[model samples]
Target: MTSPHDALFQWTFSQREHALGLLKAALPRPVVAAVRWSTLRIEKGSFVDRALRSRHSDLVLSARMGAGRIYFYVIVEHQRDVEALMVFRMGLYMMRLWERITRDRPRLTELPPIMPVLIHHSDTGWTAARAFQDIVAARGPERAALLPHIPCFELLLVDVSAGRAGDVVEEALTALGKVVLWCLSVSGDDARLEREIGHVAAALDEVLRAPSGLAALEALLRYLLATHERLSVQKIGGILEKAVGPQAQEAIVTELDEIERRGRAQGRVQGRVQGRAQTLLEVLTARFGSVPAEVSARILAADEATLVTCTTRVLTAPTPQEVLGDDGPRVSPARRPPARKRARRT
Candidate 1:
C-alpha cells in the first residue's frame, strides 16, 4: 500500500502556491517578510540519498533576493518514529546540493546559501536532535573545538503534530495551500478525514479556478484515493460533484472510478499472494532450517489451493520433501454423461 502520509505530503507540496505558503509558515517572520513570494521558483528534482528517498521526500525552491539568490530545501519526513540519523542525512543532502551546483556550473564563482527545513507529522512527535553536532559522539571542549572543522547545520523544524500545519493552512491567503494543508493534516484519522470532506471540497473548488483547473482536480482525486481507505469511487465522485460544479465533477469522477477500480483489484491480488507466501515461508522455516531455491520457487508460484495443501501438510509431514512431494491429491476428473441414454433415445 502507498503510505498515506508520504503520498499526501508529496502531492500537496509539489504545487507552487502550497510550497510557498509552507515556506512562509515554517521560516522565521523576519526572514519570510524579506522575500518576494512571487519570485519563488521550485527546483525540479531532489538530492537526497537514494536509499532514504523512499521514506523522505524533498523539494528545493529558490527565489531572487536583490543581487543574490537563496535556496530552500524542504525535507518532508513521513516516518512515525524518530530518526536519529536525520540531522546527518540533512547535512549530506545539503552537501550533495552544493556538489551538484559546483559540478553543473563550473564558471559560477558563488554557490547560493541553502536553508534546510524539516517537516514531520508523526503521531508520537519528534524526539531526535535538531542539529548535526547534537548527534555526534564528541562532547565537552573537544566537541566544541572540533565544531569549527565539522560542518554544523541546524534544521528549522515544523512538527505537524503540534498543530502548526492546520494553523498555516487556515492562515494562508491562497486556496491551493489551504487545500494542501487540509489534506495533510487529516490523513491519519478516518473519522477526521470523513468529517472534513466539505473543507476539501471547498479547497477543490478554489483549485479548479486556475487555468490548469482540470489537471489539478484530477491530481486531488488521485491523492484522495491513494491515501484514504474510506473514499470509494462513488463517495469521492459525489463529493466532487457537490464541491465543484457538475461539469468539473463529470470530468474528474470518470477518471476516479477507473483508477479506484484498478487500484482495489490490484490490492486484493497482492494481499492474497503475499499472505499465502508468508504463511508458507513461515511453516517451512519452522520445520526446516532453510528453504531450498526450488522449493521456495514452487511454493511462491503455487496457486491458492496448492498453498493450502502444503500449509496443511507441513504441520504433520516428517520431511520437507513430503510437504512438497509430487505424489499428492490430483484434481477430480470432469464428470461424463451416462453412455446408454443417448443410444436409447436414438
Candidate 2:
C-alpha cells in the first residue's frame, strides 16, 4: 500500500517470467549467460530507508551461478527528481542485504556478490552521479592516485525515462512486461502518454484477452488512474474498447464508476478536485519550469470539469496561456518527435 507505483513495480516483477525478462535485458551479457535462471528465486528484503521510501523501492532476487549464489538487487526510482547520491544509496542497500546474509549464516567465510541495478524514469533524462567515484569530494591527480584505496562500486543503471524508452528492446519482454515498462517510461508525461495510447491499448488488449488478465489489468488501470491526472476515463475506456473490445472497457469503467460513487458519498469530490489542481500545476512546472502567477491562480480557481478540459491540451500547448486558453481545452495536434528507426529485432 506504499503507492500505486510501488504496487505495480512489485506485483509485475515478482513473477518469474517478467523478472527474468528484465534481468536478461538489464544484466551484463556474461552474467546472463552464467545465471542458472532455473534456480532463480526472489529474496525478501527492503533496504530503502524511510526517507527514500516514497521515491524508491528495491527487489532482491538470487540465482545460482557456478558453485555459489549471486544476488541481483534491482532498485526502481519512480519519483520526479533524480537522486544525486545514488551511488551511496546503492552501496547502502548492498550493505544492508549483506548484513542480513551474515546474520543468517553466522559462520560464513566469504561474502556473496550482489549486483546493484537501478530502473529509473522521469520527465527528463538522467544527469546525476553514475559512479561511486563521481560523488567523491576529493579531486586532482592526488585523488586519482588514492581512488583504488577508497571502497567504490559502480551501479548498473537502466534509465527508462521518456527520452530513453526507445533504447529498450521490447522483443524479449512478455505482453504484460512490455506494457508495464511502456507505462513506466511515459508515466511522467500526459502528452507523451496521449501520443502513445494506441500503442498501449494494443499491448493491453493482449493482457486482457487472457483468462487471468482481470487482476493484472486492475493493477495496471489503478496505476494509470493514480498517475495520469489529465487522462480522462472516457478516453481510456474508448482506447480499451477499440483495442481490446467493449467487454474489457465495461469491466474497467464499472470499477471507475464505483470509485466516483464512493467519492461523492464521502463528500471528498471537492478535495479531490483541489488535489488535481495542485497536481496539474506541478506537471506544468516539471515540464516547463516556473509556472506564471496568473496560470497558478487560474488552476486554483478551476473546477473539476474545467481542469479536465485543460488537461487534454496541457501537453501540446506551447505556452502556459495555451493550457488555459480562451479557445478551450481540446487536443491540439502536437508536433511529434521523429521516431527512431530501429533495426527490426530478429
Candidate 3:
C-alpha cells in the first residue's frame, strides 16, 4: 500500500502553487534565480515500470524547468522517518534518471543538473547521511585518502518537522500549502497532532474557501483519518464544521463515505500486527540512527504486549538496544548528541 504520508505529500505538492513554493524554498537562491519559473511543470508519467516511476523519467516524483538543451529536473522525495541508506539510494536514483535523460537526447553530451530533494518530518530532526560518501565504510586514516575516488553530492533536506520549515513556508506558500505542510509535520504522532489541530484548523478554514478548496480539504481529511486512531471522526467533523462553517460536512461527505468503508473493511488483526512492527522499526531507526539486525529480528518476533512496551519507550529511549534491555534508555543518554565536541569555557 502507498503510505498515507507519501499519498498526502504527492497530492499536495503536485499542485502548481505548492510545487513552485517547495522548489523555491528548498533550493539555493542562485539556482532558483537561474530557473525560468513560467516554464515549470510537474512531469506526468506512468508508475508501472518502476524504473524511476517510468513516466517521471527523472525521478519517482519530479518537476522540470528550462527546456530543450537547457532544461533540468528537481526531484522530490518525502518521508516520515529517517532512512539510513537514503544517500546511497539517492545516488543510484540520480544516476538512473541521468541515464534516462541521456537516452531521450541521443546527441546529449553534458548531463543536465538534477537536484534531489528530501522532505522528512519526525519528532527528531534528520540525522542520516546527506552525501553518499558519508555512509561509505572506511576504516583508519586511510579512509580519508579514499575520499578522492568516492562520488560525493549532498541532497538538500527540507525538515518540515522543525521550526525552520515553518519559517520558510510561512512567507512563501499559499494557505492550502501551509495546511498541507502543517499536517505533514504532525499527523503520525497522535498527541502532538491533537495539540496542533486548532492551529491547523485556522489555516484549514482559509483553505476551505479558496479555489478547489474542497479537494484540498478532502486530502487533509484523508491524511488525518489514515494517521489517527484515537481521534474520533465525530469530533473531527465537529471541529471542521465549527472552524470551516456549515458547508464543511457537505464538502467532505464523499471522502468520508469512502474512508469509512475502507476503514471497516481493513480492521483485520493480522494487518494491524504487521503495521505495529513496521511502525516500531521506523520509529527505532529514526530515533537511534540505525537498528541492528538482531534488534530488528527481536522486534519482528515480539508479541503485542512487547510491541506496546517498546513503542512507549521509543519516544524517550536514547538507543534502540535499551528498548529490548532491562536497563532502560527512556531515562538518560549515555552521551550527549554532539559528544565529539568538547565544552567551551565561558
Give the alpha-carbon lDDT of every model: 0.73, 0.81, 0.68
What's the TM-score of every candidate structure? 0.63, 0.71, 0.63
- Compute the lDDT for candidate 1: 0.73
lDDT of 1 by residue, 1-346 (tens): 3455556666767777778777887777767877778889888777866777668888888887667778898887756567888888898888888888788889889887888998776666678898887887887778768888877788888766534454343564357666655665555465666666676576667677667766666666666666666767677567567666665666676667667788889999878977997888888888787977777888888877787788888988766667887564333456544457544664
lDDT of 3: 0.68
Per-residue lDDT of 56 in model 3: 25
Off by over 4 Å in 2: 243-346
Write one digit per residue (lDDT tens) for candidate 2, span 2-114. Answer: 87778899999999988988888777778889989999998987889988688888999999998889999998887876878988989988999999999999998999899
- Separate clash counts for every candidate: 0, 0, 0
Q: Give the CA lDDT, 0 to 100, for residue 71 in model 1.
A: 86
Worst 10 residues of 3 by lDDT: 52-61
Mind giving the per-residue lDDT tens digits that candidate 3 earns over 226-264?
A: 777677776565556655555555665555676677777
